[model samples]
Target: MKKTLYSLFVFFFFIAGLTNVRSQDISLPAPEKTGGKPLMQALNERQTTRSFTKDDLTLQQISDLLWAGWGVNRPDLKKRTAPSARDFQEISVYVALPGGLYLYDAFANTLKQIHNRNIGALSGTQAFVATAPVNLIYVADLGKLGKKEGDEIKDAELFWSYANTGFIAQNVYLYCASANLGCVIRGLVPKDKLAPEMGLKSNQVIILSQTIGVPQK
Candidate 1:
């Protein structure tokens, strides 16, 4: 009986360690920069899709999608694929996957784990959000725009942030179109509920969320 108990304890401890390691930051593969449908073809195919299969996006696909969305293109200038107002670069992309929540570090090309718990259902109000394999949350840091943590943020002040998010979202859309993936830019997010879950600071604001996955046939 004593030997059996010791074995059980060791097994549980190993499992716990594995879970912890799984939640650590992920170094994404270098994005594939070349080769996709022609620009005009991707534009022509650009569309919104709501039905997504439960199939998960491969690591390569995730890396490429993020690069297309907002990754750094001109490393020397530290410029990104999507333009930001005054180059503020206030919008940050947070990824909600079945495994956990992660923030995309465009410069490092890494996914910084925010938490291990899956928060897909909390990402949006639609039923598809919960089941989708990937959900991209766009957050704007008002502090970067000169607002203090407690300062009241106005809609006018967020005009540029909204515009920036649009640029990034569109990039993702075109990438999806080219990759034959399904995606939808969503506005029906429960921000009040999600902000805390994301552990966002008072100055960090949720701008939009996009759901992505394989198209359900």
Candidate 2:
């Protein structure tokens, strides 16, 4: 009887886990694309901030941050807020939060829940990464650029991707500055270990990661 009860317990636990993953599709409200501290002021305030508190970000902040990073700005042409190489728009932002991992769907303005695991720590080597409010993993999907599934993408082919990610990250930095938030774009990421955790394809390369949260005073 004890053995039979153990099986039932495992079955219920599995069902609860699936429910969690299905619940993270966040349909963010319309992003405010205008009225900030002006371009020149935002540029002056754009600086890297590392220290972070464990404060959770509000839904509006999350929406604004993702929108500023890569939301669709032009509905007619489907152009994003940040520029991409040849308009490839290859970079995919995977967010690791306390609840789970999610992919930021730029066009739909929603976060597609990928898995029910807190993989934020895998985003960076820093201790605070595990507990930060948000960690944005910038992954370059080569398949969008005509690369096949098993094609070995070289570093040379990734030059444009790296440059493209920088533009988006810079946008996030500026947004955080304007919002009085703290953020840092980090390159010291364990890609090989994190890629599998993020369930990325072989052609999808993780270029960099950025951590964001309230500043620790």
Candidate 3:
């Protein structure tokens, strides 16, 4: 009877572990695009300007920006503005706003509030993070890239994560160009502090932050 009880406990434990793994899968929201000036015009006008006007973006504009940055674009669900290694969309954007911090839910096409107010202090000492109308914090989940046979291969996957993040950042830059907004991507930040603040896992990495607002006149 003792052996049978032990066996049953182990079997249930294994099943529970699988259930927990399945619950963590994320489904991003559909991408929304608005008609605007051509891509070339936006690219030509694209400029990284750190100085920004103290103006907040409307919900529609915010939606468009996120869509352009990394939101899903196709009905087939295959392509995005940014390229992901092995089609593993490991990058997540955390929006830091005056009201609070929000995680962009791409699949749901909505912003889920992560905090009630500004928590830019956790990002860095820079005043820009706090003052900008919106700050996009890009994070990459290394584990999402999948397991490899060796440490070197794992490191390579991490590099791919960073590369893919740049793709998303550039997409945002171009989107800002079309919208005539000011933006800048910065890499200087305390990563260790940000990960926990953002509620990320141990294998996740904070790639960079982009501050966006109206251009200071």
What C-alpha lDDT do the candidate models reach, one value each?
0.95, 0.91, 0.78
State the local distance difference test value for candidate 1.
0.95
Against the true structure, candidate 1 reaches a TM-score of 0.89
Highest TM-score model number: 1
- Cα lDDT tens digits for candidate 3, 1-89: 99999999999999999876544432334435766769899988988887777789877778889989988686387567678878888
lDDT of 1 by residue, 1-217 (tens): 9999999999999999998776598889999999999999999999999999879999999999999999999999999999999999999999998889999999999999999899989999999999999999999998888889989988888899999999999999999999999899998999999999999998999999999999987
In model 2, which runs have C-alpha deviations exceeding 4 angstroms? 1-22
Q: Can you write out model 2's per-residue Cα lDDT over 54-115, one digit (the tens) per residue?
A: 88998788989999999888979999989998999999999888888899998888889898
Q: Find the 10 residues in a row with the least total lDDT in model 1.
A: 18-27
Q: What order do candidates take by TM-score, descending? A: 1, 2, 3
Clashing pairs in 1: none
